[model samples]
Target chain A: DTAVSQTPKYLVTQMGNDKSIKCEQNLGHDTMYWYKQDSKKFLKIMFSYNNKELIINETVPNRFSPKSPDKAHLNLHINSLELGDSAVYFCASKLRDGETQYFGPGTRLLVL
Target chain B: QQQVKQSPQSLIVQKGGISIINCAYENTAFDYFPWYQQFPGKGPALLIAIRPDVSEKKEGRFTISFNKSAKQFSLHIMDSQPGDSATYFCAASTLGGSEKLVFGKGMKLTVNP
Candidate 1:
């Protein structure tokens, strides 16, 4: 079984379109995170939820919102996406603070 | 500002040669450092990690050398193999804080047979 998984392995959308990516972790971790990897392969943390509570929110645009219905799932919703939104989105889960994080295969988003 | 800086954006090594990737962090508050390995079309996976208190750690052929005073660390892979070809990322985080990780620009390593 996969420790972490994300739906829509690939997403291709036009500009100004809205999209959502769902992530689920079977590792039974308490903390989940969303990271964006640009063309340069630089991974940056966008948001994090600890047991369904928002704990870390980066300086990302308002268009990006993360919702965690429960500790096992965290979803990212992008509103009015732009061309710069093209990147690979990865979901990660950690057992607790300062622990190794397991990552999902990632969802590739291409906004035209 | 990029908190963690990684060197050799790309690397090539022979099958039996040693491969090394270096990284430096400016955040003294960072207490945990981890290296992640990623293959094409795959998400980065935790390879090895080290804490500021530890100077070196080894797991199989992969080793992490940390210099807390210099705020720098490196990953050394011995007996490099083609199967080890992948992009490696260095990251840092502070425990009991936001717990958000700051990742470095990845280094792509190619082990040639």
Candidate 2:
């Protein structure tokens, strides 16, 4: 079974369009996170959730918002996407707050 | 500022040779350190990890060496094979509320047979 899974493996949208990516983890983890890998392959943290509680909120733009409905799911919504929003978004889960994180197959987002 | 800094953005090593990647962190509160390996078009997976209390930890052919005072750590891959070629990332996190991991720029390793 895939421990961490993300939907929309690839997303191609036009500028000013809004899109959402869904993520789910079956590892029974309590903490979930969203990370963005830029063109340079630099991974940066965007948001974090622990048992459905928002924790770390990085300097991501207001257009991007992370929503966690439950402990097993964390979804990312991008509003008015711009060309710079083109990158890979990854979903990860950890058994504990400060332990190892298991990542899902990233979703590549391309805003034209 | 990037909390965790990794060196030698890319590396090439012969098969059966040792591959080394280094990292450093500025946060004194960082208590946990982990290394992840990622292949093309795939997300990274944890290879091994070490805490500040221990200086070294080994699993299979991968080993982690940590220096608490200098806030430095490294991953050593013994007998690096062509299949071991991938991107490796180092991360550090401090325990508080929700431990958010800070990752460094990844290093791409190429093992030539």
Candidate 3:
């Protein structure tokens, strides 16, 4: 069984469009995070959720919103996506702070 | 601002050779440091990690050397195999704080057979 999984491994959309990428983890981790890897392969944390509560929002634009309906699910919804938003989005989960984080297979988003 | 800085954006090593990647962090409070390996079309996996308590930690052919005073750490792969070729990212985070990991730019290692 896959430990951490993401939906729509690849996404292609036009500018000004809206899309959502889903993430789920079965490791029973309490902390879930969203990261963006740009073209240069620079990984940066976008948001983090713990027990369905927002813990950290790393100054991401207002167009991006992260929703965690439950402990096992965290989804990223991008509104009015732009070209700069094209990148690989990764979801990670950890059982607790100061623990190992397991990552999902990432979703590649392309905005034309 | 890149909090964690990595050296040698890319490297090529021969099989059975040693591959070294260095990283430095600006935060002095970081307590948890980890090195992640990523293959093509895959997510980054934790290869090895070391905290400040121990100067070095080894897991098979993978080793992590850390220096708390210098705030620097490095990953050494011994007898690197072709399968070891991938992108390596060094990350640092204060587990006691927000637990947000700050990653380096990433270094691509190509092991030639």
Candidate 4:
């Protein structure tokens, strides 16, 4: 079984459309993260949640929001997406503050 | 500012040769350094990791060399095989608190048979 999983492996949408990506982890981890990988393959952190509490919020645009319903799940919602938002979004999970992270396959978002 | 900077965006090595990827971080608080391996259409996986206190760590054919004072780390693959070809990323995290990892751009390594 996949430890970490994300839904909608591929998403294609038009500009001004809103989309959401769901992530779930069964590793019994307390922290979850969202990362964005651009065309250049530069991966950057977008948001992080520890025990369902927001911890790190990078300088990402306000259009992106992360919601953690529990310690096992964290979802990302993008509003009014633009062409620049097209990228591969990854979901990762860690046991706590000291454990290594396990990542999901990743969701590819395409905006036209 | 790029907290973690990786060099040689891509590398090609012979099947039996050694492959090395280097990374440098500016933060002194970073205590844990990890190297992640990623294949096409797959997410990055934890390959090996090292702490500032340790000078080097090894697992199988993979080795991680770390220099605390220099704030630099590197991953070396010995007897590299064609199956070892993949994109590798270096990441750093603090001791406590958020522990949000900062990853380098990435290094694509190709081991030619």
lDDT of 1 by residue, B1-113 (tens): 99999998999999999999999999999999999999999999999999888899999999999999899999999999999999999999998888788999999999999
Top candidate by TM-score: 3
Chain B alone, model 2: TM-score? 0.97
Residue runs of model 3 more than 4 Å from their true location after superposition: none
Give the DockQ (C-alpha) for candidate 3.
0.88
TM-score of chain B alone in model 3: 0.98
Candidate 2's error at A86, in angstroms? Answer: 0.6
lDDT scores of the candidates, listed in order: 0.94, 0.93, 0.95, 0.93
Q: Please, what are the lDDT tens digits per residue for candidate 4 over residues A1-112?
A: 9999999999999999999999999999999999999998888889999999998999999999999999999999999999999999999998874569999999999999
Model 4 interface DockQ? 0.81
Q: Ten-residue segment with the worst summed lDDT in candidate 3 chain B?
A: B92-101
Query: Docking quality tier of candidate 3?
Result: high
In model 3, the clashing pairs are none
The docking category that best describes candidate 1 is high
Q: For candidate 4, write residues B1-85 as lDDT tens digits.
A: 9999998799999999999999999988888899999999888999999988889999999999998888899999999999999
**What's the TM-score of each model vs. the native?**
0.98, 0.97, 0.99, 0.98
Please, what are the lDDT tens digits per residue for candidate 3 over residues A10-110? 99999999999999999999899999999999999999999999999999999999999999999999999999999999999997744688999999999
